[model samples]
Target: MKQTIIITDCPEQQGWQKNRELCMDVTTYLRSDSRMKAGKSYQGVLRRDVTCDEMHYNEQMVFIETSNQKRMKRNPRIFEGEHITITRRDDGSYHPNFRPIHLGPDFNVDHYATEVANELLWGLEGLVDNA
Candidate 1:
């Protein structure tokens, strides 16, 4: 299995560069768990123009292993592209779609990112336990 942390903004490089710290943390978090067979290394892809404009839209998606003949219904839905994006903003800072920064819409970039990571890891945990 492969895991990635992609961060994007207007300029692909800027977005990818900015969130490396968070990515490192997430990488460490994932590797520390027993289920991470790949160890601490990760491959990432960042982009400018992306498929989803809103980053917070997909909290987390988990998918079953393709090799499995029968897929079991799991808690976390897995898929691909564990990405984070800054879609809406003002004063040049990323803002959560649910959170407007001032009014506190709902989830900010950091919070939203954390939420996504948690969901993904939680799903992986389910896989490990079931296995």
Candidate 2:
């Protein structure tokens, strides 16, 4: 079966740019430090679309295949949409808290989309590191 994936930020909220900028800022910070061990490879994209069975906010999902493997496995959920944001920290891990923005009285599409993107990126990070 085909899977549909959506990765976007609401145009009304300026948070989209903020998220991208935060990624770039974090990349820079990680690269500049002397004591930290660089991962040697990193890639990120804005509004990147991905297909997978598992989905979560602020965490990455991955799919692996082998000749003898019979079934696919999924990981646990990480963060929620209402708890995502980018904050600089002394620690090496990248922990961005993504908060949902209300479109009106009850809509929060931007926040939802941002979390998906964050999760996808996190998944990509794991895949690349393993590769």
Candidate 3:
């Protein structure tokens, strides 16, 4: 099933870095009319773009680069006008394997993807958080 969501606010970067790569945890401070609960908003990590030379400096960097490469190989980044469509699991269940959405430029395909992913995360049965 495809759900449509309109993002009211752009993602705001949190003060802390999530890893050595300095990727920040961002929060989308907006409520939607979709599956998102009344008080809840979406949260995600901001990706860091590293140069090729930086990857050779440390094992962690190399590993991060390798992992990123592998993930991109499996599911490449969505472009400006393209949205990632995740197929529902068999038996008509929602699986929460969400992907990262590009947040640059106008919030069209990327923003919608992020909002739908948040909806899937917070709305799906047995996955909703009570806290």
Candidate 2: Cα lDDT at 69: 35
Model 2 per-residue lDDT tens digits across residues 10-69: 643534333232332121222233443457432222233344555643523222221333
Per-candidate clashes come to 9, 8, 0
- For lDDT, candidate 1 versus 3, the one ahead is 3
- Candidates in descending TM-score order: 2, 1, 3
Per residue, candidate 3 scores C-alpha lDDT tens digits across 1-131 of 33655544442343333434364332332232334356744443334334347446322222111111223233322222233233445454433444566676776876695867665544443233421
Q: Weakest 10 consecutive residues, lDDT, candidate 2? A: 21-30
Candidates sorted on lDDT, descending = 2, 3, 1
TM-score of each: 0.22, 0.22, 0.17
Per-candidate Cα lDDT values, in order, are: 0.39, 0.44, 0.40
lDDT of 2: 0.44
Query: Ten residues in a row with the worst lDDT in model 1?
Result: 20-29
Pairs with steric clashes in candidate 3: none
Candidate 1 lDDT over residue span 27-57, tens digit each: 1223234454555442233223213455543
lDDT of 1: 0.39
